[model samples]
Target: MPHDAKAAKAGTRPGGRSARVRTDVVTATLAELTEKGYDQLTVEAICHRAGVHKATVYRRWGGVDGLIADALALSADQPWPIPDTGNVDEDIQLLAREVYTTFTDPDLRTTPTALIGAALRSDLGAAALSAFFTARHQQAAEVVTRAVERGQLPADVDPVELVRAATAPLYHRLFITGEPLDERAAHRAAAAALLAARAGLFDAPAP
Candidate 1:
């Protein structure tokens, strides 16, 4: 029998045994998902890898879907490295370059790529994925915010929109068209986003 969904929504408690358990379980989940892919992932395998009792996982996370969601939720709360170059143009270019490096680098790509691919296979994971991107966008928007403060960008430009514009093409090529991404493409995307922002094309709509 499946565990209650309400139990899964309780979230991981910070500190002590609960925190350790959450860490172990999430680590195990990522390992299993990376090694076996989503279709082959199983609660029993996760339990064995985590070395935590099956009952504990079921009672806290409910099932595989809940585990996946919580994993993404945890990831979202973690700090992402936002660029800090004094020049807004360099910062934006670095932002796009970071994405390109992450997805295209052999050592860095496997786990995150597998995690996102698995997330696309389930509704619970999908919602978590949405939250994950939202959190990332908010964090990255700081680059644009600082640029505006320095008068490098128009005050009316939407920070999140500018950040999104800078990096969205790489994501489209990566997750959609499966096109090969190059350094030139990353630079081009950043340039186009900056040009549009300068032209006031990404100004926040009057509310």
Candidate 2:
């Protein structure tokens, strides 16, 4: 059940041990989130499950929400290496795939859902959620803007708006409609947004 075996293996690559430690910590946090909900989750519980010392978790993450946020952020694949398929449609599809993959992971889903619920009930949670959403949106906007700069999208496209259109449907399905965000939905959302962007629907309003 230990998640750090690879870290302990002989001849493992440099950074492998540290990477595995981080992975174990994230995994433990996720497990705790699923089992106890965010309200009941604690740094001590995560440290216990990860088989790491309390000081290790504290020194690394600072506190419980900090640990949870880091774990959730890692669940999303890194944003760098965004594909350049020589076409806006292809790039949109790739971005959608990454979002869908991250959101659909069972373990990752619990943390976000719990966080959202907590946010609704607590001012501190609400503030944290606002910051988290802002960071996530900024990253998505950067990718959309890069596509625009590459001439794949119209010069006037509002990257932030385009990203919101692409992700709004998924949020509705997951949070409002209580439906699963399946592959078909992901493809439809991406394709629709890409088409609109191609047609200049995302163009900025007249000054």
Candidate 1 structure quality by residue, lDDT tens digits, 1-116: 23444444454344656887898899999999989988999999999999999999999999888888889999999999999988999999999999999988999988888887
Q: What lDDT score is found at residue 163 in candidate 1?
A: 92
- Which pairs clash in the backbone of model 1? none
TM-score quality measure for candidate 2: 0.64
lDDT of 2 by residue, 1-207 (tens): 354665466425566667778888988887787789877988888898989999888888787776666664564445545656666677777777766776788765666676565444555545665666566666767777777788777889888777777777887887678888898898899889888877889888989
The lowest-lDDT stretch of 10 consecutive residues in candidate 1 is 5-14
Which of the numbered candidates is closest to the native, going by highest TM-score? 1
> What local distance difference test score does each model get?
0.91, 0.73
Backbone clash count for every predicted candidate, in the order shown? 0, 0
Model 2, C-alpha of 73: deviation from truth (Å): 7.1
lDDT of 1 at 175: 77
